[model samples]
Target: MKILVVDDEPDVKDLFEQRFRREVRNGEFELAFANSGEEAITYLSSRPSEVVLILSDINMPGMSGFELLRHIRTDFNAPPPPVVMMITAYGDPESQQQAAKLGANDFLTKPLDFTVLKEKLRTIA
Candidate 1:
C-alpha cells in the first residue's frame, strides 16, 4: 500500500519510518512525505492514483489540511477516492466534526499511537 503523509514537522518522516520499519522493509507499505499542504497537492496532482491513503496534519502553514481535503474531494474524480485520514494535535470535537463533514475517512490525534494506527490500516488493507 502506498501512503502519503503530509505534515509540516520535518521529523515526522523519521518517526514514521522508525515505527513502521518492519512493514516498510518487508514491502508491505510504502510512504511518501510532504512538508505542507501545497506540496501534498502537487504530489497528488501528479500521481492521482498512485497513493491509496493520505495522512494529513490539520494545521499546516500555507493551506490547511481541511482545505486540502475539500480540494481532494472536489478534484479527484476517481471512483474510489483515496482514503484521507486527518491528524491534528488539537483533537477538538469541532475539528473532528468538520473533517467528517468534509469526507475524511478517519480522524487521528497527534502524538500518534502506532499500534492503533497499524490496527486501522489492517482493516483498510
Candidate 2:
C-alpha cells in the first residue's frame, strides 16, 4: 500500500518514516510526503491511481485540509478514490464535523497514536 502524508511541517517526513520503518523495510507499504495541500494536489494529478490512502493535517498554510478534502471528494475523478484521514492538533467538535461533512474516511488527532493507526490500516488492508 502507498500512503501519502500531507503536512506543512518538514519534520513530518522523518517522523512518519521512523514510525513506519518496519512496514517500509518489509515492503508492506510505501510512504510519500507532501508539504502542503497544493503539493498534494499536484502529486495526485500526476499519479491519481498510485496512492491508496491519504493522511492529511487539517491546518496548513496554502490550502486547508478541509479544502483539500473537498477537492478530493469533488474534483478527483479516479475510480475507488483513496481513503482520506484528517489529522488535527485541535480535536474540536466543529473541525471533526467539518471533516466528516467533507467526506473524510477517518479523523485523527496529533500526536498520532501509531498503534491505533496500524490497526486501522490493518482493517483497511
Q: All models: lDDT?
A: 0.93, 0.93
Over 4 Å off, model 1: none
Each prediction's RMSD to truth: 0.8, 0.8
lDDT of 2 by residue, 74-101 (tens): 8774788889999999999999999998
Question: Could you give candidate 1's per-residue lDDT for residues 1-125 as a string of tens digits?
Answer: 99999999999999999999999999989999999999998999999788889999999998999999998899874867899999999999999999999999999998899999999997887
Which segments of candidate 2 are over 4 A away from where they belong? Answer: none
Q: Which pairs in model 1 have colliding backbones?
A: none
Error of 1 at 50 (Å): 1.0
Count backbone overlaps in model 1. Answer: 0
Q: Give all TM-scores, in the order shown.
A: 0.97, 0.97
